[model samples]
Target: MSSAKRILLTTISASPRENVNYQFNNQVAIASQAPVALIKLLPIHELPDKVIILCTQKLYDEQYETVRNLLLEYYDQILCNTLNQRPDVTEVRIPDGRTVEELWQILEAVLHSIPHNCELTLDVTHGYRSFPFLYFTAALFLKALRGVQIKAVYYAMLESEETEKPIIDLSLLLDMVEWFYATRIFHHTGQASPLCELLRPLETPPAGVTGKDNAPYQLVKSIRRALENVSAAYAQALPLELGREAEQLLRRITQPIPRHMEQKVPLATELFGSISSFAGSFALPATRQRRIRIKEVELNLSELTRQSSIIDSYLKQGYVNYALGMIREWMVSCAMWNQMAEESIYRVDWWIGHKRFETEHKFAVLARTAYKADGNTTRDIITPEQRWLASKWQFFSDKRNQLAHHGFRYEYVLHSPQQIDEIRAQWEELKSFVSSKPHWNLEIKRGQGTLLLSPLGLSKGLLFSALHHIRPDEVFVVTSEESAISIEEITNRADWSGRKYVYKMKEPFTGFAEAKTISRELQNYILKSDRIIANITGGTTAMQYVIQQVTQDLRLTGIETEIIAIVDRRTPAEQVETPYVPGEIIYIEGQGRLNPPPND
Candidate 1:
């Protein structure tokens, strides 16, 4: 809300030619409504009134005086005749930008010189390797620590002499960094607030985007609005609507690798795809079909395990707040799990804010209702285990409530081994409760029905796509030693923690002979499996051919098998419209469904 971005901050470096010469040619009017000539002069219109040149000691001692003389001469001849008065330029000295700490110190000095409540327009055009990064970090720090708003970040790519250099705003790139962190938060806690914050900026189109190909701008606004709807759906306890909206947003907002310089936003696209996938696939236990329920439990258990692992990492690294947040989230999830039979699994709004039940009281009420809901009045419904669980839940509920309402005071907070044990007990209890379902145990259990054989090459998207859609009993990744390591990492990070079913072909399966040898081993595994699915999306030509041939041979021998491939159509000629980036998972029968797929 602090709108007075009066000062433009730029770094002085070796090449000061562009610093003085580069006008914002082909520039559009900024959102700030500064004059075109003024914008061309400073390049960052948000910093409308003044410019501040932050010079390191090295630059000032070596090249600052010369640059000042050149700037003064340019001002005297060209700028003086055209403008009313010379632009207010001031030089501030700082430490050398040699080390990260030194650059940070310089950044601190620069930030301290600015007023606390003013907006910032940072020009990262000319700086050393770490200078641009330091500025970005400083901008974030100032925003968090000092309540400063970063209006825009301008960079003039002064590479070619002939091509006109318009000032490009990289603010969205910086927001992508925040988006990445927000994504991690969402994955950890399943909260929509971080995602809402991410989309808030797109309420208005970015500066200078208009005319015919307004798809990006319109799509961004639509996605932002859809995310707002998702947040509302979360509040209203409508997971189905939330998932549907998120799916719609994914289709609307997704963009391919752009042809124009102005069209590229790789980070935003990646973050959007990740979050949208998470939200779209999310389901409430009561609303989902049997198969979807199995998948929901699978994804939930994996996410819980990953969150616990991250908590351990945080505690090891002495990140108390992060650990506390994770544990508190776990506690809330456990409490919610107790009330899951009431069909309240999707109602996050109840736990967060229910008009009738306050936070602390709600947990106690939920505990009683959950334990006593079974129609056995003669006998005490609450077992010894349930009693113990309820007691621990009360303790966690109190602590969690305190932490949420009050603040984190490490000295006064609880971190005993007993507390840890209770949290782990709750996690195990929830896991057991969910895993009691027949389908949940069936798909997650080792050596079950479906077997998906994927030849691992480069792209891991196909493997992930297969894993998400088809809950395969075991995933056999056929690749060399090096690629096996990479694939394992991908699978692990995808929340398949401690899963031993993802097997790598021990034999060298690169050639026809070696592939045949591996196929024999795969035959045994497939014979045990109820149904077989061959993902012919990744791997070398020889490897894919071997899989197709091997599976086909098995089918002839009366084995049930299906071959599938993932294709991401980027060109218009491929289809009427693309869905979910990777297009769609389609059945591949002979050559009809085998359009050439992207290489890994």
Candidate 2:
């Protein structure tokens, strides 16, 4: 077979808006040269069969179209001028968008259109957001093209002030790619190995062989042996000098053969060894072998506790780190909210003094310290409040922890009913408080008292008092009972003097007659007076009749009257005070005096 290779080259054109496009262009050209030189330096290279060139579509619109056209125009001239040989090339276009899904779809479409055997080259210097896409695409490509050799070129642009040359280390990147490929290969090939059979007992053992049988015991040993071999081989292939370290790790892991081996040979041997010693010392039936087996199983469990403790410590440390991370996230979320709500204008000194932001910074230190304390096992350290707060910040932290440590999958973390209720209550309280209307000096009183007359037009009666702050020139009194106090008596008693009085008959009248009477009475009385008082607090009909009469009179004559509602005092031998105290009413000099309560 010809030792031919496939190569992919990518170049990113800098935008005109970029601060140093000239420098970027030179860097890209240099980066482009270095990869081609590296490929030529490879020992077993017949020239590459297929080459793919990747570039941003944005570059085509902004800068590279002219360059591309020039290259096509002077293709032979460029080849003669340049040191490196140019290979057959296919251009792959990367789309522009803020969303990963959009970019992913565009990339997927582009890759789908390309021939299956071709390798991918990514140019990712423009923006950091492209890194995830590039990594994911490369990983996927490696998975799809299993046997194909892949190479990566990383470019770091240098500043003029820096004399140190920019270095691109492709070793780690290449190692990662190779590891992914190897893992895929191992996963596929491992399916056919005896290791797969060892794993099978973990899923489903043979029908006759109960879990207590020697079959499971044997399977554990077999699995441990296979895992050790694979791990040793993998370590031997590692490029690192610490193959001894890898072997040590494999040895340590292999020391604990999982107690549940398919065949119970080790367990049976231990049990029989113990029983044989006791055979001379004690009397026991042959049928008691099952009892001895049970005893052996119990002994295995006691030993497992030691192994489980090691696993638990690791798990606990992981949980602690997880919890601390959640706490840090929550603190960030709260700080962001506080900043947004307060416009970052206020509370700077408070935030600095209290160190709310600084507290979150300590998470890194605390996480590391806790991890170390828990024997580098995050699962062992329990960050109780941190985990709780993490759940508060994002409901997934606790659920994620359980899955990580406990291997639980089905249960999901969600807001508890109590948490929901508390949140709802707080929201309702805030809504009510924010939306409530302001109440001015308006006051409502509920009591029986004498109506006192004040310059503010307050009436102090035997049972109640009212302040008619709005005054009228003429007084209208419409009462059903003639025995009730007259308008003159009320006005005189309340010291409402010089106010005109108009009386109407208690009976209803014809429309025009009623209208004329109302007009004539209001015009005659109000034209000469300064205030009009209407009292209508009694039985329902009496109040209604008085209201209608006063309303018609005022509407016809355009007189604004101060109406006082009055209810009669029914209790006897007990003096009823007005609801309003005399001191509560302020009277101007010319305004009438508000009568005080009668001294008993």
Candidate 2's displacement at residue 479, Å, is 99
Q: TM per model?
A: 0.44, 0.28
| Tens digit of per-residue lDDT, candidate 1, span 1-600 | 344646667765564442223445454322111122234455323334456677777777876666555444444565555654555666788776677788778877877777776677888877676778878888888776776777778876556564444566789877767777777765445456766665555444556767756564566666667666655654443443444555555555555523331243446556666765655454232332534212233224544454455455444444444555556555445444443454444543433433213323433433543344354431333344445545555555655555565556555655566766665555455445543332111111113456778777655555666655565656676775666766665565344432334335445344666655665555435534566778887767766777777776555444557888876555643322321234357887532222232332
TM-score of candidate 2 relative to the true fold = 0.28
Per-model C-alpha lDDT, please? 0.55, 0.37
Best by TM-score: 1
lDDT, candidate 2, at 115: 50
Q: Cα deviation in Å at residue 494, candidate 1?
A: 76
Ten contiguous residues with the weakest lDDT in model 2 = 437-446
Candidate 1 displacement at residue 314 in angstroms = 16
Q: In model 1, where is the ten-residue run with the lowest total lDDT?
A: 438-447
Candidate 2: segments with Cα more than 4 A from true spot: 1-5, 16-51, 55-58, 65-86, 113-122, 126-128, 144-147, 159-167, 174-249, 252-600
